[model samples]
Target chain A: MIRTAISAMLLASAAPALAEIHSVAPGEGAQERLQEALILAEPGDEIVLAAGRYELTDGLSLDVDGVTVRGAGMDGTVLDFTTQAGAGEGLLVTSDNVTLRDFAMENPKGDGIKSKGADNIVYYRIRVTWTRGPHPENGAYAIYPVESTGVLVDGVKVTGASDAGIYVGQSDRITVRNSIAEANVAGIEIENSRNALVEHNIATRNTGGILVFDLPDLPVMGGGNVIVANNLVVANDTANFAPPGNIVAGVRRGTGIMVMANEDVLIENNILSGNPTAPVMVIAYVQPYDDERYNPLPRGVVVGQNTFDGGGYDPQLEGGEMLKAAFGGELPPVMWDGLGSLYVTGDAPGWSLNLTEQGKGLGAAQPAPLAAPAPEAEFDRTGIGAPAELEARLSR
Target chain B: MKFGTASLLAASLLLAGTVIARATPPPEQYVNDAAIMDGGLPRLLSDYGFFADAPAQEPVPEVHPYRLNTPLYSDGADKFRFIYRPAGAQISASGEGLLDIPVGSALIKTFAFGEGKDRRLIETRVLLHRADGWLALPYLWNEEQTDARLAVAGARIDLTTPRGEAISYRVPNKNQCKECHGLDREVVPIGPKARNLSGDWLEQMVAAGHIDRMPQGADRLPLWEHRGKSSVEDAARAYLDVNCAHCHRPGATASNSGLDLRWEQDDARALGIMKRPTAAGRGAGNLLFDVVPGDPDASILLHRMIVNEPGVAMPELGKATVDEEGVEAVRKWIAGMEPR
Candidate 1:
């Protein structure tokens, strides 16, 4: 019995001692060193990338669980993929409980820093830039996390993507806070996901700022239970540079905080300015779909108190001049398609399309002032956002 | 039971004869079975002793050569495949699924380019079936054609394809191998399913006592050389099964897209018939649906295969040039579909 107790104590002390640090420096053979460090790392190990420029030709990946990849700073450590010849992304993380922080990737041929099926992942203080401004040939997304649960993205900056700057798709329990998404097609988009909290972010100079959508024919469906609050969405008047046939390519040039085909979404306490399109728009899915499991209507969407300034002055809608003249120069702060359920907490001025059903053409709409009823009760705040334990990693 | 005993006796006799012939054997002449089961990574490809002559592509005893019915296109480079089985161990097989390779076994494949005299081996990849799981590793060949060293980060080489296009060839890194061989977060072998193997190979293995029995669904995929005799649908389905099904099916990396191109998938909608893309982004390329019936020109699935762009290309790795033959087969199948 005494021997058993001593062995158990030894086992307990061995774990922390086994954790190691693998430091990689940038120079001639940084590609081999950094990639070897990523592949050979063990669980609970840390891989540190020193401050320099890494000229990489191929993509890198990590599949070790509970590993942390850190850099000196987001600006100090740059992974330049200007001459990238292969692979689908700049860096791919396929392991669970991984933390990636303080690194920047420039001019990747595809999406930048994609994490698929990597649960409980944290992406902190990272930057992904296209170098060239908005162009149709830029990579799809800057920071993409898909098909995973418990994702936390904090203090990241992304720019000049043809698609969404920060896109989280087909996942649950996501929190995107204190980030900046600029000069992309759609800034900060949450698609086909659930229980998301997008707060305290700055979204500017894109085609659409802050979109929450539920697309059809995905593995996970019925995206809802989202809260978009305390964000600064302004001046998203850049022309849509997304390649044609993408869903975001159909987005208007100056949209702010748009929610499409979702359920039980709450938009509150945001500052909207310099948006020519409607400051807050809610609508049904416009395209025809064949999936029986899909519901293309926006239901239980509530708009709470928000500040709107200098918006809707030059709306980007069909018959914009006629609508402006009808509304006595400049439309209202909110726009609805009149095919779904919407609630307003106060007297927020808005207009509606007044369409009868889904998949109806815009020509069938009868324009009228919005007459939304007040919300019935308090919105449920349970089981939202990433798990609180993810914050502890940032502190470490 | 008596027949099984007789076959086992004969197998042991054959092994004993081969061992007696190599009395003063050079150390590298035999396979290193311990290296296959060990936990540490071997630094060089020759450390495993898979090849008796590292330059001539010769195999040692108990190493078997195999071929697939329809192979994946890797810029038209020739592939040499081998499987190494330890003494007294057997490979188990089910109907049409992947072969159940036992622990301490390894699969080696070498990719080479050019004709008889100018032939150069670029890289050799191995899949070691260890105790924990299958581990994939890549080794790069040297300029002298002597041996290959382990390259965890992979390398790029400039070469000309068979189609006369000058391009850069990329050898996949250690983790990049998992991008194609991963299922449910575990590394696995993508090729060597029973359906893709020939019936004659299975019979020969069974006779030699290397495998338990003939697989039920053996020799189902159409051969690439004899594709002219097969139907367009058969060839097209075989191409999709070998090239696209690794990541497109459920529980794989691209599972979020909701498209399943596996051979056994029967549902029309699951096979991307008029299915809209969820997150194709710029890869959609002005196309609406993934597959438009009777219109190959409008199908996003065909467009992605034809394009050479990085983000838009299908089978994101291992192919730098378009397969014109594969594209024609898929186009014919799609053109024959009935539009609804």
Candidate 2:
């Protein structure tokens, strides 16, 4: 008995210390208390918010690494910024290994949740929404992670952003899955990023479903190796409400997926339907640009096995002018801008369109005429195999 | 009697030497104290005494006191009085052409409204130079207006402007202040550039021993009222430089857009002339380019400037109302542009 007691005591002593949990309740100065908790938290500390509405003026920022901020539930705990007077983001994380979960941010003056130059950030079960619906005055982004690495956003629902609902820019090794994006300009945008995996997300009633784009003159470039698969992208016929001069403004109303100026992107196994414009579009980054460092061609794209239902009727005449001219009013399920360099020495082309097991209606438009000619034989199924293999090769 | 006079003279000289030595001590090491009082306030401000007298008087000349070339336009609600206080003898200019203020310096900007008997002080934002980085501290004035208290989380004050406009002035938190003030992901001063300070202020700073020498060929940024006085291009560029360049400059927060509006930037694309918007959503206002050469109405820059919407507005923060005069100036400049 004595030996057993000693062993139990030793084991108890050997275990790590219990992490500190700071709880905040709604009160006159609840925001202040929460802010104090964030500032006072150490590594491995958890700051929990009770189930109530907390009205905040200034946004909250966490710079303590290895801290966890949790709420009672996404629908129970609410952080409302309706009367926000500051310009800072709702929840700005500038620390590594920070996990934010089970919270909802409402009506921020700026971005909802933003992480800058941080790494190993995980956001789970978070909802960011504008209460007044979509307008030009809405915040720019719902969940914006910029210049970060190893970011994982899962089970988040975002809506009513003037810009992209879930935007990952200038980041690397990002995974956004099991999210719902609705009523935003671009539903889920992976811009100027590398090695992103977007899968199993439900994108509906947005301007465009998913976008993989590389903008010029950013700190990071050469965005590639993006896999967008097994998602339900449907009825994204929302009129592009994005303000002018943004790259998303060029997106057609009903585009399911768009790949612009990116390389080695694999699109597979998604259910795309009810999009009036082309379901999938591959185009060059031919906007009037001055940065010479950016590559403007989409190369090595493999599209396969996506179930398409009811699309390409009543296309956006103005937004999809090129596509409309090429394939008439009834657009195709997949479209490509056939403008890129040719392979000089090798038997293969610089950019190859590998389409297999896709449900019909695919077309390509030449760069010069901007009109529909006969389908080019070179772009017609260059014998690329399964999308999984292509994805594996590209990722490597 | 002669011996007594000699001893008295020696004592006076000793006292003078003590005073001089105390005035010119090395910069104090920084400590990250959450409570601003822990750093020993009232004493820190009084000992350093960047101002010549208490309760807002003249500035101490030896502190290398200076002012901005053009002030950033806050909401029409409050007016600001800005002063720069370098820690040591002089400010060393960095190779990147920005003022490398030594640690322990401070940028003090006092926000107030009205003048004379109706004047009411709002708050003072102090950008303290620390070893790790610049720390922003906001001190809210008491009702009596005799003193201020350090408010870290920030405060909101409702007041009427001199123009009879009722406004709610939001004192930004420390992170909010760093939002635009951060450069290359590091907290730095927004103003005090060679191009912005190329006017008489540079000469005055040089004369007061604030800087060793003035940078050659530095372009001067004119005040906003100089719209009608100077060339339209100069006035427009100055307005953008003061209001937008802090975030729009290269390596700054808005550099992701590929637009650099620093006064020294000569590239047409960097200046956003005929440049397409990168990530602008509805901020583009259906315009084709940021600037459409000869068409101001068609320029997204002007559209963002004129709008008060959250996503479409330019400068994004610090202003609740539009600066009609600034918008008109830029409009005239763009209207007068020759199409490329």
Candidate 3:
């Protein structure tokens, strides 16, 4: 008993004396008070919100590093932007080592939660939604993190987004787990990102579920080493409401899993059901882009041991006429564009499709090389490098 | 008793006049509520003492004033006056072509509508240069027209324009002010570039001792709408430079698109001619290219500028309605361009 008391006294003395908690209640000028609290918070400080509805007109921003913004509960503390006057994201975070938890942001004019260029961020039990349901006028993204690293999004619920419900763009080292995305155009999209693991998430009633894409003209290109496994992708039959010109606008209505213009991707052990068109689709980025530095090919894809059910009943022909003609209105379980490499060096063809463990579905159509072989040219082994090299390049 | 009261009132008026006539002191280095209030700056919207002794509207109104070569169009509201006050010393030029003003400087812009007694004052945005960094403070005027108070979280005012059109004006919060004013997430001034400060304005600033020297051979930006003052191409480029270049430039938030809309950009692809958008979504309007040389209808730039939907707008902030004049200018420029 004497030793325990002595250790407790020592621990109390070692704790920082400046740590503080600021609690805010909903009232007039509550938004301003919250903004002031965020601006005045120091490192390791916590700003807590009471259980009530707070009406906000303008978006809030936080740039103080290592601060925690918490609420009473996700269902209890509500930040409603139904009458927002300003544009831009609802909560813009530009600081490192920040944690946002236990709050609900609804019906912002733009993105619901956006973190830009920040690292070591965590979002826990946060919900973003449009209360008016799915519409084209909804915000673009519900939970968005761009150009960030070491991001963890856990136990989040998102819905009613015109674009992707959970979008991680041009980022690295991201893990999105235990999240639910519903009634969005593209649910849980990972675009131009690397070293991402999306698992244990429920994506339902969206236009497309769990898309991994690498488009041209972005600062960070060539996404690789993405693992999409152990997720429930079901009944993504919502109509595509995304505006044109975005790559997601071309996403078919009932696609369960899509991989485009990326390499070193593994899609395994996911339960995909009730998607009318296809369970898995892989294709190239065939859009015309002027940037010469971008590579628009899907390479080194591995599909293994996924349980699929109730697909290939009705397909959306706008996905492509080729697939419709090939399947005659009932699409396959796994589909590939079958467009081989344009540059025909003596290298092992730019990429390979390993379908070793795939079972009881229409097999992928591996396209033959279109270009003639050049035996005298040196072999270009750049595209077929080891996974470790790809991971290192992505980490940088 | 009446004679005694008259004499007492006369004495107080004399003392108040003496205080008002004295030279105003410079503003403090850092802006706080108490400091600004104690400094005795103009509190009312029509005080007419902070800038010049004359009325609000004039050709060259106020002290040490400058204007952007091509101003950003905020809804349909007009910025009748743009002025600046250097705290202690002149602004020095930086190597990156940005003006590095001293810590105590303040950039003041007043947004107003109409003229004379029917005029309505909207809001004034003050960008105060502080010791730590620049601070954005927005002051909203009350309906009594007596004084304005600092609004940190912004306000929404419903008013009718002189043309009898209704508008809901929104004053940006402190954080939203940093959206366009910041570069690489650091809050800095976006205006006062060498290109925007050339010609007679540079000569005048030099004469008034606001800046040490004028940059020579600096490229000047063309005015957006001055009644045929500049060519169509110049107007279009200037509009894009002011509206989109703040985010679309290199290393900016929208730089992932690879479209650089800065005034100094020369590459065709970077200029968005026949260039595909990176991730425009519905903002693309099903258009193939960002800017198709000879077709304005097929251009994504024009489509985004004309639309006001949540995911379709170009600027992505501070505007709920489209600027028809800006859209017409860009349309005319695209229509006149020769096919490449």
| Per-model lDDT | 0.87, 0.70, 0.70
The first chain of model 3 has a TM-score of: 0.81
Order the candidate numbers by DockQ, best to worst: 1, 3, 2
Provide per-model DockQ scores: 0.59, 0.33, 0.35
Tens-place lDDT digits, model 2, residues B165-248: 677677765556766787877788777677665445555555555566766644466644344777888888888888888888
User: What is model 1's DockQ versus the real complex?
Assistant: 0.59
Which candidate tops TM-score?
1
lDDT of 2 by residue, A1-396 (tens): 653554465467742134567898877997778877886576667898999899987678777777788898789889998977655468888778778888899999778998877787888889999987778778778999888877888889999988899999988888888999999988999999988889999999998999999877666889877888899999998998776557787788898988988877777789998887767777777554567788877766666568877546766744456545654545657666564321111111112233221222134322232222322223332222222322221111
- Among all windows of ten consecutive residues in candidate 3 chain A, which has the lowest summed lDDT? A343-352
Choose the strongest candidate by lDDT: 1
In candidate 1, which residue pairs clash? none
Q: Give interface RMSD for all predictions.
A: 1.2, 2.8, 2.6
lDDT of 3 by residue, B95-146 (tens): 3256767776666676666555656667877766666677666777677554
Model 3 chain B: worst 10 consecutive residues (lDDT sum): B53-62
What tens digits encode model 1's per-residue C-alpha lDDT throughout A1-396?
A: 643554465468855334678999889888888998999887777899999899987788999989999998899999999988788789999999999999999988889999999999999999999999898888889999999999999999999989899999999999999999999999999999999999999999999999999988888999999999999999999999998768898899999999999999999999999778888999999988888999999999999999888558888899999999999898898899998899998878899999988986798989899999999999997988999888788976
Model 3's number of clashes is 4
For model 2, what is the error of residue A337's alpha carbon versus the real structure, in angstroms, after optimal superposition? 3.3
Score chain B of candidate 2 by TM-score.
Answer: 0.78
* Ranking of all predicted structures according to TM-score, beginning with the best and ending with the worst: 1, 3, 2
